[model samples]
Structure formats: structure tokens, C-alpha cells
Target: MQVEIGSNFWTYSLCEGRERKLWWESEEYSKIFLKSGRNAFKAICNYISADKRKVLFPAYHCGTESEPWYESDWEVEYYPIENNFTVDANKLKQCIIKAKPAVLVIQSYYGFDALNDECNALLQECRNKGIIIIEDITQSILSDIRHQAVDYYIASLRKFFAIPDGGVLISRQPIAIRKIAQGDNNIPLNAMQAYSLKREYFETKNKGIKEEFRAAYVVLNELISVNDNNYAMSDVSLKIWNSFDFTYIAQKRRENYRTLSEGLAKIDYLAITRTFDNDTTVPLFLPVLVKNNTLRQELQAFLAEKDIYCPIIWKKSPRIVDCPKETSAIYERILCFPIDQRYDKEDMLRIFNTVEKWNV
Candidate 1:
């Protein structure tokens, strides 16, 4: 299948879905606002001080996710995540007590997975200690299982839908949210253009098209750092969010993930890290780690030649974030293959064939 940074491009049908009201801002729940995930993180960090700037996050993450903490003058530290992307509770507790960050950020990678009992215990301990918890569900936004007792929730909805730049932030407590109004329409404009360019590149493989796509990406990347963006999702983002049925999207993703997981599990070349255990968990992607780093790079390049783009999940952070050896190894070896609802079983088989034919 054709892929770009993530999955399939937005179609006109996506623009035609019905509107879904904002459900997270009610009394029983928290106040949910829309922005970029990094911007959302920045808004929360505004409430804490330099001493409390210590934010304990998972070892595996993108630089942008951690940049808010760094910019806030927080002592950003990382706790270990297992090879399977599961939290190591005992290790996490140790890091928490040692670092004593003002805030703790936990990511439910790829949406459907939940925290283990021991990890839950650690979450309780953090809460008891009065640590501000920020649960990032950018991947798990629509998962049936959710994090409880968290002070704040953050997610990048733009990843799930064809939205033009949107992130959701929820504050369980009645704290007045903060933001700076941006009159510029550059962010959404760039976002829309970026999507169009990628879809075009996918359709027409002109060599220079990628350069144009990269230019659009650079603009989108620059837009994310905006400090003062007013409340709510963009007017356009709300329309895109409203036009779709989440249940259908979630189910389709599950079907695609399960199909790929079963077929890939039989192969011996690499270790599959994520498996769809049931219907409730919707995977953002199918994660696999090649045993050899060199072969992994080669396999990725081979796929790219055929227009099957795979995400490396993330590269090692240039800033050393005190990660474990296992976590570091994982960053270097894993591949995040797109298994969203964009394609069917036959499409997955095509991906499997590419890997199967790789000369590892």
C-alpha cells in the first residue's frame, strides 16, 4: 500500500462525516481543549515550577513530545518500558522516587494496551505522592481501556483522523486552562497542503514530489511550536472530527491489525512486539523489531523503494534521557508498520511479502 509519514491520506468522504460534540469537558469529567500535543504539554507545564519541572516519561518517545518539558526548564528523565512496550512498574517506581518529578507522563503506546497490575500500583503511588499525572493517549485516543486518576490527558487527534492540526487536552480539576491566541492561519493551511502533497506523491511517483512534500512538512513542523494558540480544535479540525464514526474506524483498525499479526507471527526473521489480544484495543500500527540493525535498515529502504513507507517509531533522542539498555536497543531495532483501517488483508500480505523477501 502507498504510505507517507503515517497512513492513508484524507479523502472527500472524510470531509462529509457528521459532527461529534466535545464529550470530555463535562462536569463528571475534565475540561477538554484542542491544540497540538506539544502545545498541550506546554500549557500544563505552565502551572509547575522549575524545581517541579522534573517530568518522568517513558524511555521510548519522539523529541517533540519531550521538548515541552525541556523548554519549561524541567529536568526531563525517562523510566524503562519493556521490550514489548509494557511499563516496568518496579523500575518506574524507583525512577519516580529518585527523580521525584513534579509531573509524570505515561503513554499507552498504540492505543489498545493497558497498564499491568504492578504498573497500576505505581500509578497509585504517584497519585498518593501528589504527583501530577499526564496520560498521553495520542495513540490510544479511542481505546476502550483508559487511564484513571490522571490529572491531565493529552493526545494528538490529527494522527487518527484527517484533521488539519489538532491535539486534545483534558484537565480533571477545574483549573482555568491557558493559551495565547494565534491569528495566523498558517498552521491549518500548511496542514491541509501537507496532506494534499503526500496524497499526490502517493498517486504520482514523480521524483521531485518528495521535495515538495518535505517543504510542506517543514512548514507544518514550524507551526507546532506556536506558543499562544487560542482554545478548542481548529474550526476545520472540528469539522473533520465531526464527520466520522469512531466505532467503525476503531473496528477496522482492529481487523487489519489482527490480520497482519497472525500472518507476521509465523515468520522467523523478526520478533513481533504488538499483538491484538481482543476487540477493545485498536492498534495505531503493527510493531516488529528485526534482530539485526543493519538488516532492519535495509528492509526499510527496500520497502520505501516499493512505496510502502514504514515508521521507525522513533530514533534515539539526541538529548540523553537516562534510558535503560533494553529500551535503547528497542529504539534502534523496531519498525512501526502501518496497520490502520486504510487497507485490507491483501494489502497486509504485500507488506509481509516485502519483509519475507528481504535478504537478512
Candidate 2:
């Protein structure tokens, strides 16, 4: 059995007629049109006046890839939590009171759940304090809070869908976006490469050959450019969204997550992140926190040998703040296992069996 776990594949494949149209309409908001990924981030930065001098407080425990894009001076104040990693309201309040940030960025980790009460309170406090709140919906798009409580919200469309490059930014305030003057309709080599890479990824999966899948990824990564202009929000992305069925994709993701969680329950030292009460999310990945650093790496290698790719989702480290040394150390132990729509019961059983065998 082979399991593919590099990224979240788009769920548009599951929908029919009017239901598909509804998905696109649901994402649009009054005065705010969804802009492409990085462009949306740029627009928010401009609206919030977040330059290189102002400080932003991001939850330190969250993913690090997006923090630098803020292009502003920043400090990180992580929310305190117990063994289960729930957001700590009191600690969060204290941090907000002390840091007095201009903007607060929050993330729903692993899409495991939506914003907890503590998280909601923090957003309210930020609002009362007149600070901007940028919600990262990259992992938690299924949560209702994406439409509520944020001055601005951003999500990577490419992460959730099969499309090459796209991100949507929804805002409460209206602003004029200067449309780019179209001249050349030439598709950039990089965008074409990424498109090809995604095709190859799925192709290898269908073939049931794990080694070929890895090779496809290597080629895909090489051809893909992280900073290419062609992949910027284009007609192709919007067309893809219009044609796909997001609801079906969301349902499949939730179903797959449940199946994997149930199958892996008996494994010791492997605990999945629990969703918060009254919150729903299309869980992006199933993260299992192991007991020790050695076990984490060993499990990763064991899975890889079987062509089951498991990766470390987040490596906790200090942001540009004077955080306590102990907090920085937790970065080494978290591992994320695959739970997307691509894996079936047979594939899940293969993963679980690998873990059980490695228990000794």
C-alpha cells in the first residue's frame, strides 16, 4: 500500500451543479473581493499600515512560514496551554496587555478545530484596543470564524485545492484594486511547471508506485518556483474554483480524518490534536505528538521506508521576541501524519501497522 502526504490536494472533484456555484458565492463578502494569496497579504499590510517599524504579536507556537511576510517589526507572545495545546486565555490576555501590538495574527492549528472562546476573546480585545486582526485561514478554512471577527482574512487556495497558485483575502473595508493592464498572455514556465508537478503527483498515486511518486515530487519541486509572477492570481485559478466542488472536498477530508483517528487510536505515544467545542474545521492534517524526539524521527524514517511520507508540520522556535528559552525547545517533537482524501482504509492500516511494528 502507498500513501501520499506532501500537500493537501484540492477537493473540487466532489461537487455537481448549483452546489458548486454556491461554494464560490459563499466565499465572497460585501466590499471585500477575494484576492490571490500573496497579493492578499500585501493588501492587508497596506491597509493596516504594517511597515517595518510596528510590532505584531503572533502566537509563537504556530507555523513559521508566514511570519516573515508581514514586512513589519514584530514580537511573538505565545498563548499558554496545558498538555493538550489549547489556547490559554489568561496568558493570552496578559500578553496582549503587555505587548500592545498594532496587529494580532492568529492561526487554527492543523485545522483540528475553530477558534476557541479564549481565541475569540483575544480577537475582541484586539478590536477594543483598535488593533487589526489578520486571520490565517490556510489550515482552518472550514471554520465559521473565517467570516466573523476578523478585520481581514487570508487563505492559500493552492493548499486546499488542486489549483496551481491562489489565495483569497476577505476584508471588511472596501478598497480599490488597480487591475493589471493585460498585454502578453504568455503563461510563465514556472506556473506551467507547478501545474505539471501536481498532475504528476496524482499520476504517481494512481499508479501505486511509491518510488515514482517521490521522483515526481523531486521534479515538481525543482520546476516549481516559490516566487514566480505567472502563478499570481490569474484567470485560470478563478476558472478552476468556479468549476470545482469544494463542499465535497471538505466532506471527504473530514471523513478521512475520522477514519485515520479511529484506526490509529491504539498506538501508544501517538495522540491526535482534539478540536475545540462549538467549532468545525476541515482538518488539514492529522498531527500526532510523540513522547520524545528520538521516537519522532524514528517513526518518520520508518514510514518513509514504506513509502508513507510523514512530516514534521511545525518546528517551534522563538520569533523576533524575548521569549523564554524553554518555549523554544518544544519545536523538536511534533509530527504530522497524512489524512487527506487520497488515503483509504487499506493505506491507513498500512501506516498503523508500521507504527505498531516500530513500537519496540
Candidate 3:
């Protein structure tokens, strides 16, 4: 197996000479009707007339998914969460009633829990108030949490799968739309390269080789960074992404996350995310809050030296907003460890051992 470190240390075997297959076969991949000028998020925005009058009430703690969508015409407001990252349901309700936002965004952090009844009730209330709810399922996938409740649901498929770039936006109400012609002619080479490398890595797994695969991954990430143009979905890449058995991947991820949580539970300084009430999530990564900022950075650096890639998933504040003091404080202490299907028990042990050694 090959090993490397960055946002998270990942290990994989190679799949150099294998039969080609679709990523998902039995189940239909979520259909995305793509228009030339608009992406999934833009489509959702158009549905809500967000460009005309956009207002987002994002929960304080989340990744960059909610920040980039804010436009000049749109006013973004952050609602505070308690020490545990759970929003105050009453406060959320009160804020929505008062602000009358155009859209309310909710992120299922770490995919460990679903929206609690209180949160759902608040979402329902917002719906009744004619406010749209956009669920960010970037981190949550398998719990079968119905998206029917929300006006629009979105997820960045890359975070969950091995594919390089894909964002899914599903809406219940069909708005006037247009599909981009297949030969629109502006495919980003860099993005396509990343997607290609990711495919290579996935295919090569289990070939009893790892070093070349790791090198390819590094190159792929570099390409992704340099490519500024948005990567539009290609027919081939979409087919590959949809071919993988999602059920197997999700089950493996869930089991791996549970193993990591149990193995590292004794680390007092690390505060892992607990399952939220009512919601069931497919855990993406095992996020921990270190005792202090120094420890967080030190551990990160130490892990990097060992080629153990741990990624800090999101920036603290992408823009100027009066974020809660608690959220800001926790952001400084948080780090995410790999707990996806790509890892196993030995991988978990290695991570735990590394952390324990550093604790000395």
C-alpha cells in the first residue's frame, strides 16, 4: 500500500490493469440538468431569484460551501450555535421570523446526525413563512434523510467519492431550465486531469502497489489547484462516478468512522463530534477539537512530517461576519482525520499511535 499525508493521510493500493466499470450501476445517479452558464448552485439561486434579493441565514459552524454563494445583492447572516455546535432551535426560529431570509442553509456536520426535530420544525416554519431551505449534504449522504422537506438540496460529490469534481443540486419544484449542449467546448484541462488521476487511483487500488498511485494523487491535486476554470461534467466522468456501488462505499465509511471514534475516544483533549438527535449521517471525517491552538498546529505539523495528511476542512471565516465567539474559538482547535472507506483498522491504529506519540 502507498501512504501520504496532507489534509488527511490516505492509503490505497493500485488498480493499474483492471476491467472498466461504471461507479454506480443499479441505482440512478442524481440527475443534474446542466445549463451552459449556470452550475448547480446557480440553478438553485435562479430558482429563488437570489440575484435579485438573496439573503442567507447560515449556521455559524460549516465549511466554505455557504460563503461563496453570497452576492452583493444577497445579504448573509450567521446564526450562532451552542458549545456543541447545535443551534438554538428557538433562536433560529426567532431569527427566521425576524430576518425573513430568502434561503436558510443547514449543514449536517460530519454526517454523524440528522436535523433534529427542533431544527426540522424550524425548517418547516421557515417553509410556511415562504422561506426556502437549502440543505448542504456535502458531509452527509447515507442516512436516507429525505430531501423532500427542503426546497433545494446540494452536495459536492468529490468530498464523498473518489471523483475529482461534481456538485449535485436537486430541487423538488421544477423551475424553467435549459441543458447545456454537450459540445459547449470549454472543458477545464486541469480539472479534467484531476478527475483522470482520481480515476486512475481508484482503478489501481488492490493491485498490490501504492507508490505510483500516491505520486499520481499529488499531481492530480496540483492540477486541481492550478485550474481556475470551473470543471464542467463530462459524459464519461459522470458515468464513472455513477458506476461505483454507493451502498458499499457508504457502509464501509460508516464502519470505519465508528472504529476511529472508538479507538480514539480516550484522547481527552480531542472532542469528537457526537451523533445529533433524530438525524442519521454517513460520517465523513473524525473531527476533533484540540485543547488549544498550539496543540492543534503542533499536531498538524507533526503529522505532516510523518506524511499523515490531515486536512482542516474549512476556513474559519471566508468573509466579514459577526460570527459567534464560541464558533470562532472551536474553529481554531479543530482538525479532521481520515475516516473514509480508503482506511482500515491498521490505518486507524497508526493514526492513534501517531497522536499518542506526539502527545508526549
Candidate 4:
């Protein structure tokens, strides 16, 4: 079941047809702001109380994933999550009391779990202190859209769909936002380029198409690197996003995750960072932390030879790479397996069996 490189990145295939539900959350979210999820974080930061400049971020995270925290001009502060990515309420409360900061960003790692009870209580503490809560669900958009008590929610819809440009900002209550209209060649042009590269590879089975795709993305990313990231999603990207069936997307991802997670569980060397019950949490990917960076490289190479490629979660951010002793130990070791809707049970089994076979 091997295919072209970059074809199976976290989300499902956009070129194929599948069952879909025409679902929109206009009512649930006061206003649905369409943009890249990365920009949504910046927008949320802008909307928060102007007085609070310092925001607490989790220690275990990808550097770029939290770029909005920096872009919003807030003094970003770090807090620690356990090896499993769960926050301790007591420790978090202490940080809040010490920082007495304005905002708290809570992330649902891999979108397969919810905030722990202690963190839930701490969330109330933030409310009591009039602290703004920005929930980062870019990886777990469907799990919890609007927190009843949270001020704002942001998710990267592009990750879940084939659309090139998409990030959504949901206000529990409607608020005014000044942003630019998003008719950009960067996202749409780059996104469609991805589609074309994928299509060409599928049809022609040519590796040459990837260079064209890579060049497009290079230009697209360069544009993104310079923009303020306060624009809305493009019309073409939005149309592509709306055509998908939400029900099918979620169900397929859950089924694939269960098959892979169950199989991974049997191999104790690879530790699953989080686990969900009754499939309540629809995962973005099945994340596992190998024992060390050396082992990680070996495993990645081994998997690639078997036609399975897992990406390092993100290039670890230098700021948090060393301080959070735990994060430093395994940041390079984290690898994510694609468990999206595109693959079926057989696919999941192949992935699992390959990893298991590697262990043997």
C-alpha cells in the first residue's frame, strides 16, 4: 500500500469521493471565521483582553504550532505537561498564580483526549480570575468545538480537509474582527498544486511531479512567512472544504485509529502518548514516542522501507526543546502514523504488523 511521497500526510485524500454530511456550525459558533488555523490563533490573541500580555503555553509542543502566541506580541510563558501530555492542576494553578497572566492556551494533544479533571478545575480558576482561555484544537477540531465557558476557539480546518487554506475562529459570542479579504495565490495556488501533484502521481506514478509540487509549496510558504496571517480563507478552498462528508471523515478516522492503536498497544516499547475511550476522541494521528532518537531514526527508516512513512511531529522549537526536561528527551523521538479516513482496516493492520515486525 505504498504510494507517492507526501501523499498521505496527516489528513485524508481529497481527490477521491466518499460519503459526506453537509454539516455547518453557524449556530454553535457565534461566527465562523474561515482562514488557516495558524491565523485563527493570532486572531484569538488579538481578541483577548488587551491588558493581559503574558500567556501560558504547554511545554510539550511543536515550535511552529504555537507561533501565534509569539506573533500576537504576548510574552509567552511555559508550563509543563506530563510525559503523556496531561497537565497537573496543582502545578498549572501555581503557574497561573505566579504568572497571574492574562491568557491560558489549552491544547488537546493528538485530539484523542480531553482536559484532565485537575486542568478542568484550573480552567475554572482562569474564569474566576477573568483570564481568557484560547483552546487550541487545530489537531482535534471535531472533539470539542465551543467550550461553554471558554472565550474563544480556533482550529485548522485545512488539516482535516483537502483544502489548502483553512483556519476557523469561533467566538462563543460574536465579536468584531478587522482582517483582510483572502484571495491569495499562496494558499489556493499552493493547495491546488498539491492536488495536481497527487493526481499526477496517482495517474502517472511519476516522482517528477513532486518537484513541481514542492516548488509551489516553497513559494507558498515563503509568502506565508511574510504575511501578518490575518486574512480569511480563499473562495476555492472554502468550496473544496464544504463538499466533504463530516460523518464519513470522523468514522473512517476512528476505525483506522482503533485498529492501529490496538496493534501498537501490544508492542510495549512504543508508548502511546494518549488513549481515548469508546472512540470519543477522533484522533488526528496515532502518535508514539520511541525510546530514544537513535531508535526513532532506525524505526522511521525501517517503516519507510516497508512503505510506511511517519513524520516527526514538528521540528522542535528551540525555546522549549531544552527546558522541559521530558520534552527534550523524546521530542525527536515522536512519530505520527496517518490514521485518517483514506485508509481502511487492512491498511491499519499493515501499519501495525509492520511496526510489530520491526520490534521482533
Candidate 5:
């Protein structure tokens, strides 16, 4: 059995052979596929032609999600997000009143509820003021608590699935933008190479294949960074995305998250970021807020040594808006455990056992 966890996807061979209906097809929203979520956000900016339109984004973000706004010359402001990973509704309301932004971008971190009761009320307040709400569902793609107040929904699919390149823009109203030219093939080509090499590494347990896989993965990321050309989702990726069984995928993620949560509770060195809500959330990852910054680094290295890799949710991105101390502290201490469809209870237990060893 493959022991590696949390990294670029290995080659995907499983396909649900029957004709399948995509989840988004049931929704009324007109959808457009893009090369990346950054490009999707850029499409929205291109659609909204206005003079000096202001936008409000959460302070705690991956940085790329909010870049299109700054690039489009929109006046940007940040609202506070509590350390508990919920929006500070009162402060956000105050920001909305003060800034009167033309657009508001909010995210439900790690597949948690995008808005609680109070935040929902704040969303209504924004709607009343004619603020265009953009919900970044990149972290919460499977989440059920989709707020209807949102004017645009955007997400990067690369985080969840094995797709080489994909991002989607969804809106209830018709979305019109200039035709996107076909993207360069290097990004997807390198991505497929990395996945194939990773699969071979697992089968043969070859150290060289693993190193080559990492190198290819690095090159893939670098290619994306330099190439910001807006492009439509490739037919190859679209077909792969359609073949998957999302129902089973979502169920597996929830189960794995519960198992990890139960196991992590007994460890004092780290704590799960928030309680899992079984009803609404299909968790993207089981995020843990490690107590000590130094311990967090140690834990990540320890896991990597055992072929279990946990990703830091966001590094200190230079583009991150200035947030309060609480948000900053959360960023410094946060780490994401793998709880995706690729693993079952045995894999989750493997992670717990390895972590228990390091807890000593």
C-alpha cells in the first residue's frame, strides 16, 4: 500500500464508468471554467467595469485570491477574521459601513461554514447596501452552506482533485467576458509527468523517481507563477473531473476528518482548528493549530520523514493584507492534516500513530 500522504496527486486510474451528472449542472448558476482561481477572479474584475470600485477581503488569505482586485486598480480594505476561523461579524459590518466597498470577498476556511448566523446577517447588510459579494469556495468546495447573497463564486479545483489544471466561476446571473485563448501546454504536461513519476515511486519505492517527481512538481509550480495567461479549462481535465464520483469522495473526506479529529484531541502539543460540523461541512483538510511555532515546524519535519506530509495552509505571503494579532498568530501556528478521499480509516490511523510517536 502507498504510505505517502498530502502532496501532488499520483496518477489517477479509477474511473466511474457509468454516465455521470456533474454537481454544478443542477445549480442555476451560469458557469465558466478557467485555468486557475486567480484567473477566474481576474475574469470577474474584467467583467465589472466601474471607476475606483472598492473591495473588502478577509485579512487571512492565501494572497493569490485577492491579487486580481489590486491588479484591476480596485481600492482594497481588509476585515478581521477571528483566530477560531470565523469572520468577526461586528468588525466586518463596521468595515462595510465605513468603506462602502463595491465588492466583498469572504471565504469559509477549510470547508467550515462560510458564514455563521452573525456573518449571515452581515452578508444581508452588504446585500442591502448593494455590495457585490464574492465567495471564494476554494477551501469549501464541498460545503453545503453556500450563501445565496454571493454574486460570484470562485474556486481552484487543483486543491481537491487530481486535475492538472482547473478553476471555475459560478454565478446565478449571466457572466460575460472576452474569449480566453488556449493556455500553454507546459503546465499540464509537467503536472502529468509528476503524477506518473509519483505513482511509479510508490510502486517501485525508488528514491530517484521520488526526487525526480519533486523536481517536476517544482517546475510545474514555477511554470504557473510566470504564466498568468487566462485560458479555458482543457477538455482532458474536464473529462477527468466528470468521471469521478463526488458523493463517495465527499463521504470519505468527512469520515477521515472525524477519525483525525478524535485522535488529535488527546495530543496536548496540537489542537484541531475547530469542531467538525457533520451536517454542513465536507472538510477540505483537518487543520491543526499547533501550540508552539517551533513544535509545529518539528512536527511537519517528523511527518515528512515518515512519508506523511502535512501542508502549511498559507506561508507568510507578502501580498497578505495587514491583519490583527489574532489572525497573524493563527497563520504562524496553523498546519493542515490530509483527510482527502485518497485515504480511509487505516491511513488516518497511520497518521495518528506516527503523530503519537512524535508527541513524545
Candidate 6:
């Protein structure tokens, strides 16, 4: 079998599922389900029309997360993050004071808890100053670290699950919203059709299906990039979300991550970016930092030849004016190893063995 370890989710077949309450279904928050994460962020920016329209973001990011801000014409500033992707509370406090941003957006990368006691205290101070806190839980969605004190939370559910299109916006207090409406375009429809083709390609290994499926992704990307309006999630995608067995999914991912960590412990050319608590973190992927950029790219190509795919999480964009040197280096050297629920310990071992062979 070809070991396709990363990339888009395949089509999911509906099955009997477990009954449980989602993390955001609490009575304390009013929620809206959107077609994608970008829409959720756009809605929040529209809702919170701050006097200055200034917002703060972390320097280490995928670069696309700030699009809604720019689309809405908000002034954006970034605060530096440590090498391990954690925020320094003192530095964060200093940035807030200097920037005087009306809004602060924070994220916990790869399902690990980024906020400690000191960070939480700093956020409380920001709230006291009437700064709105928006936690981007895209990576930390299913993890145990849910920050309720934040004024708002936004996440893309499709990132964590096999849904075609799903994003959510949650506010601490009840907020009046217009009735949910679909976008005038067909991005969701295109995505579902693309995923369905991907599933067929997986089953038949047909070259034509492969070409069509790949091309569909490119078209879908263009559609998503230009889609700025807020839209509701499709009925089919929401049904898939409702039918997921989240508990089992979390358990399998944790096991796979632990297995990979154990197997790669002796490798010298690379290291896992951050340590995560097994009890709390259901990591989205195992982030590995290579010693340099050239070696990282070579290793990525070597693994791809063996059918074990890994991804360089992101490239730094020129629009980010203030990223520190260390953070920029991370963008060049960091790679994400697949540890999702779809693969088991054996799959992780394949990744480790492949990397080990390439290292020599």
C-alpha cells in the first residue's frame, strides 16, 4: 500500500457513533457554525468594531490566519514567540501596553496548552483594560485546554476531522446574529466533490482520478481565497461532525504521537519542537525541527520517494514586518510528521525508519 501520511482528509463513511456533548455546546456561550475558519474570523472582526481597529498576533504562524484582518482593514502587529512556540508573558504584556491593540488573538499550537498561569493572568489584565481576547483554537480544538474566559473563540472543525467544511464562532455572551445564509458561490460544493474524487482515487488507483482530484484541490483553493462572505456549514458536513467518535479519535492520536516520539528519540539531525502532556494534548501532528533548511528539504524529498509524506507547516510571509530571527528560522526548518488517528503505531514506525534511513 502507498503510505500517504499527510494532506487532505479522505471522504468519511457514516457509521454508528457515540453520544457526547461537544466542548463548545455549553450554556455559557452563544455559538454559530460557519462554512470555514476564515468566515468565522471575518464575522468576529465585523462584530467587534474597535475604535482603533488594531489587533495582535503571534509571530510564529501559518501566515494565512491574518487574512480576515487585512480584508476587514484592521491594523495588525505581531509579538515574538519563543523557539518552542510558547509566549513569554512579560514580553506579551509589554507588547499590549505599547501597541494598545483593542483585540488580542492567541493560539495553542498542535493541541498543546500555550497559556500558563502567568499568561492567563496577563490576559485577565488585558480584559480589565477592555481588550477583547479571541482564541484561535484551530490546532487545540479537541484538546483539554479550553479557555472560557476569553471573549470569543474560533476554530475550523475540518482541520481536526474528516468534514468537507466546518468552522465555528463562539461568544461568551449572547449576541444577536443575522439568520445563517449560504455564500453566493459554491466553494463547499466544490470541496465535497473534490473529496469524493479523492476517495475514488484511493480505492481504484486510477491515473485519471488522480489528475482530476489534484486539479480540484487547486480550484478549491482559489475559490476559498476569494470567498470573503460569512456562510453556514452544509447539512452533510454538519451531520458528519455530529457523528464523530471524538473520544476514540483523541486516544488513537495520542498513542501514535507517543510511539513516534519513542522511536525517534535517538535521532540527532532533528528534534520534536515541543513537549506535550499526554493527558491534556491531542496533538494535530508531531512537529520536528531539522538542523537546517537544505537538509530539511532533502529529507522531505527522500521520504516522499518512499511514499511517507511530511509537510513543512508554513513559509514566512513578507507582510509580517517584525518576526524575530529565531521564529523565522523555525519557518524554514520545522516539518510536521503525521500522527493523526487514521494511522497506527506501525505507520509511525514506518515514518521513523524512513527518516532514519535518510539521515545516514
lDDT of 6: 0.81
The reply for model 3, stretches above 4 Å from the true place, is 5-30, 33-38, 50-52, 61-64, 178-232, 275-280
**lDDT of each candidate versus the true structure:** 0.74, 0.56, 0.59, 0.70, 0.81, 0.81
Q: TM per model? A: 0.89, 0.77, 0.78, 0.87, 0.93, 0.93
* Candidate 2: 10-residue stretch with minimal lDDT: 180-189
Task: Please identify model 6 stretches exceeding 4 Å from their true place.
Answer: 15-18, 178-180, 183-188
Q: lDDT (0-100) at residue 86 of candidate 2?
A: 50
Ranking by lDDT: 5, 6, 1, 4, 3, 2
lDDT of 4 at 288: 88
Angstrom error of the Cα, residue 275, model 4: value is 3.1
Candidate achieving the largest lDDT: 5
Judged by whole-model lDDT over C-alpha atoms, candidate 4 comes out at: 0.70
Task: Work out candidate 6's RMSD over C-alphas.
Answer: 2.1
Stretches > 4 Å off in candidate 5: 13-23
lDDT of 3 by residue, 1-360 (tens): 235422322322233322433222114334453321125555555456643365555545443454346532466676665545566777777767677677787766677544568887777877876777887666665555554458776766666655543556665554454543342222234345444554455466443334554565566555433322334555443554546665666676676677777867888888876743442456777788788888888888898887677777555666745667767765777788887777667777788788877753
List where candidate 1 sits over 4 angstroms from the true fold. Answer: 1-8, 12-27, 49-51, 197-214, 225-232
| All candidates: CA RMSD (Å) | 2.8, 4.5, 5.7, 3.3, 2.0, 2.1
Model 5, span 30-131: residue lDDT tens: 999887888898889778865549988888887787777788788878887787788877888888888888889999888887467898877887788787
TM-score of 6: 0.93
Give residue 76's lDDT in candidate 2 (0 to 100). 38
- Candidate 2 structure quality by residue, lDDT tens digits, 319-342: 435543333334456777776666
Sort order, TM-score high to low: 5, 6, 1, 4, 3, 2
Worst 10 residues of 4 by lDDT: 4-13
Q: Please give the distance, in angstroms, between residue 41's alpha carbon in candidate 1 and its true position after superposition.
A: 0.5
